[model samples]
Target chain A: MSNVSATLPRKARVPIFVVLVLVGISIAYPILYLAFTAFRTRADYLGNPFGLPSELTLQNFISVWNNYGIGRALLNTVIVVAVGLTVQLLVAGLAGFALARYPVPGARYISGALVSVMLIPSQVLIIPIYLLLSRIGLVGSLPGLILVYVATGLPFATFFLIVTYRSLDTSVLEAARVDGAGFWRTFLSVASPMAIPGLATLLVLQFIAMWNELLFAYILLPNDQLRLITPALAQIGGRFTNDQPFVAVGLILTALPPLLLLSFAAKYVMSGLGASFGR
Target chain B: MTSPVLAAPVASASAGATGARPPGRARWRTSERLVGIAAVAPAVVLVLGFMVYPVCYAIWISFNKTNGLSFDYVGLDNYTKLLADPLLHKVFLTNLIFLISVPLVILAALVCSVLLYERIRGWRFFRVLFFVPNVLSTAVIGLMFKSLFSYRGPINAVLAQFGIPPVDFFAGAGSAIFVIIIALVWSGFGYQTIILLSGLSAINPEIFEAATVDGAGWWKRLWYITLPNIRGVLALVSILNVLYTFTALFGFIFVMTAGGPGYDTTTLDYLIYTLAFSSTRLGEGAALAVMVFLLIGGLTALQLRVFRVSEEN
Candidate 1:
């Protein structure tokens, strides 16, 4: 039961910060190098592989974005991330709200089961889900990918929201109910607003997960026109193997959305992710 | 996984179970039960439909052979085939080989977190910067590394700058797997650090203050008080890493080496992907998947046992 202080002498902090700088550079260098190189032409890269680009150019970015089917893939990604995330938040949110606030007999068991199922390694389910989706002819379709994403994301969403809702005060919900609001009204209005911070954090995290999810997207969406952004980027990389600048640009385009979002909302991302791991 | 935080909720949850007395509490309990049922039904049905059902069906299909249009029941045949297949044996060996990297990852994470927890300057910026890699798509990271390690990439370019001969990183099995391990640790280091740092952040500073007053130096205080207190979280992060080491290597392998240089980088998950989709041997692939699930299950059970034992101490 001691205090939570992290005090250090002035002289000691310098060496520790040096260590921090070393660790930070190693973690950040690959990403920064790739991004920086994308702004260069192949000749520029050959001239200096490790240094910043001599002259910035958007040619690589424009070429990859317009020509490599990234435009179509970006649309497909939007459908999956937007629609799939909505379904996940809705289903997981409602279930967590019920389990947290309601008195259903089997709710606890269901909540526990959903959370436990998340521990099941996903590769095992890939084969069967592929077969199932193929049998129903949902393979190569956006809806099929969305369904799988929602299913996979449900456990985390439900698990996190349940913990979040349980930790929330119930007095507001009680007041809303006293005003003659029905269950849906109370939950949609009171509980959800109170949980907005958590909800937004989870939404961004889910977006990043789906935006970057490649394996399932690879297996499910095999059709050329319907491929998502990640697969699109990977395919272009393989196609333009000799053109390092092209591949670099493709990687940057694919990585940009999440990196930008994360940079802006790092607080939410860190806190949300920390909350998940802490549990 | 069996920590008091996660485990304690189970007992209290049963208090609101069904049958809150139909006669006495009938009026109030009706709406509550109805809302609860309606609320949870979606998640229950979705999980059953997607996750639970598919897993069970996969186990069932593990016993049969299948072509595009036909299926034949072959009880235990798939398992027997998997058992005797030399490639799978190689895959298991490779998995063991790759596992040597897990502890290194944990150590890196621990060092970073402990330093940050010691009030290192700009730790917040470093944390966010480090975490940027974790958010990037695996394919992006994988392909970037693949290019960076290519014969003429920056790595070799730098080597040549130092007057060293050019080296083919992916030309040999050892070097290829080495690259894969580096990518594995490099990508994973950030996320694990953030988790471990949070665990460190939760530690009471008074513990350190008291120790310092008693003439304990930083290293001694870290070794004795900090390490022992976060034993639960260390176990948690390591256990989670076990699962990732087992399966998550697939993305990196696919983009980086495609398990090349004579199947050197192929893990069990990668092997299953190649078998099922590449070779179109669904039965054998399904069989391998079941084995992976069992291995992960055993690891999880071990995690819980360790977590619970630590709780008692």
Candidate 2:
């Protein structure tokens, strides 16, 4: 695959490579700029915004963590994502498995309903979800936000896993059933084990999603202390216009988890993208 | 019904003794049904309780006037007010302007994907690098752009070297929308490229070889062969980008411009937030939400029709 440029003459390849490299730099430069700005003092950044930092400093990171309440936000986000991902996976996984394999009553309708739910623009749901959460006394709480994430996330997650489960070797599931393994037993001991790759893909996709979700997290968790990392970054960025480096630190912190996940689980993340669009 | 593995086991079980109904088969069927219901119950319940219920409530709220807590049935009053509201019209226009980014993103993605399809050196690295922005939170991307395009930001610094004075990228509605569109394209094209690359990979290499033998140059091959082959994927990508532009732009607008320069860059999604939460006009916001929802549905359906017609060719 590496040398598949047969149609391109040797001379043309250089310009193509050059254009790609320039595009690559253009895509990467903003992020790289953020990192460089984050490490510099405010004065250094203001004086030389485009150049490398004259002197490295941890002041921005420390101040953002301490004074900007990013520490609390980080902890809050972890709790939401951790609790949210687990419940989302459990609900989506079981439903996906059952719908795919079992002769569930109304399975087609249910599947169709889930797909339609994905079509509903979430903006329409926000006002009412906020109202409902408040009515249920979960509004402005992490648990309420978690519920929103799971609810909004279920349609796609369940759909993705259904595709995953359907592609699993049915003979393995049949063997488990023949051994008298019930649904739960087979799910835990046989089917899910074989579905680890699919589950991992869903997990990575959902992890990044929940980690980066802004609107619901911002709307549901109005308390400053309860702000998720993304919303916290937004608030800090909005509040401190003069302190670019400090805000850059917040952006870096907000982006770090997903970027790390991308680095380590790029395959799973990229694979999940196709599943998302049902391609 | 289509599962041979499932049917095979059941057939063997029934054939073991008399052709009469298997005694435990009925019990097992009931158990299986029970298990299926149980497995799917949590998802069904949550979706119903949260998604379905809120949408219904939003429909109700859209017809009546309410803040957030209480509602008095005003019966189309909210919808009437929004219909007459100039801000809604302006915001709708803003959204339409944002739609321009979709084609821009697709064009960039097409070029990159075509180049990458050749399997040039470092294609893999470039693929991943391009997708990095897609993984980052919108808030991060928005803020990164905010800083990058700020009057005193690096963009201005670089411009100063060219003797072009600093430009306040966010001061006016025109400049602000331009900045937002640029940010949208910058962040969006990478993912679309990845999708297009996958679509490209699905095309037979033999087709390209045959085209090469037929004296088709690279651009000619791309124009005649590559473009037609990926039309379906391009359609899919276009629809996704359209939906994204309409629905998923709140965070970007929120952090980047906050719909700034006096409602110039306020997208429909962002306006919904401001109306419902900031201004406490929940009824009108809900009405706007419904309108946006319908608009998106209609636009998506229209695009599907257009693309389907083209695809048939």
Candidate 2 TM-score restricted to chain A: 0.96
Worst 10 residues of 2 chain A by lDDT: A1-10
Off by over 4 Å in 2: A1-3, B1-28
Q: Which run of 10 residues does model 1 chain A get worst, by summed lDDT?
A: A1-10
lDDT by residue (A118-224, candidate 1, tens digit) is 87777898889999999999999999999999998888889889877776776777676668888789789888999988999999888898999988999999998
Q: Pick the candidate with the highest TM-score.
A: 2
Q: Could you report the DockQ of all the candidates, in the order they appear?
A: 0.57, 0.57
How do the residues B136-236 of candidate 1 rate in per-residue lDDT, one tens digit apiece? 88788889888888877899988998999978998888888888888878888788898888788788777788888899988899899999989878888
Model 1 CA deviation exceeding 4 Å by range:
A1-7, B1-27, B310-313
Question: All models: lDDT?
Answer: 0.82, 0.86
lDDT (Cα, tens digit) per residue for candidate 2, span A176-249: 78888888898888888999999999999889888988888888888887888889899998999788999889
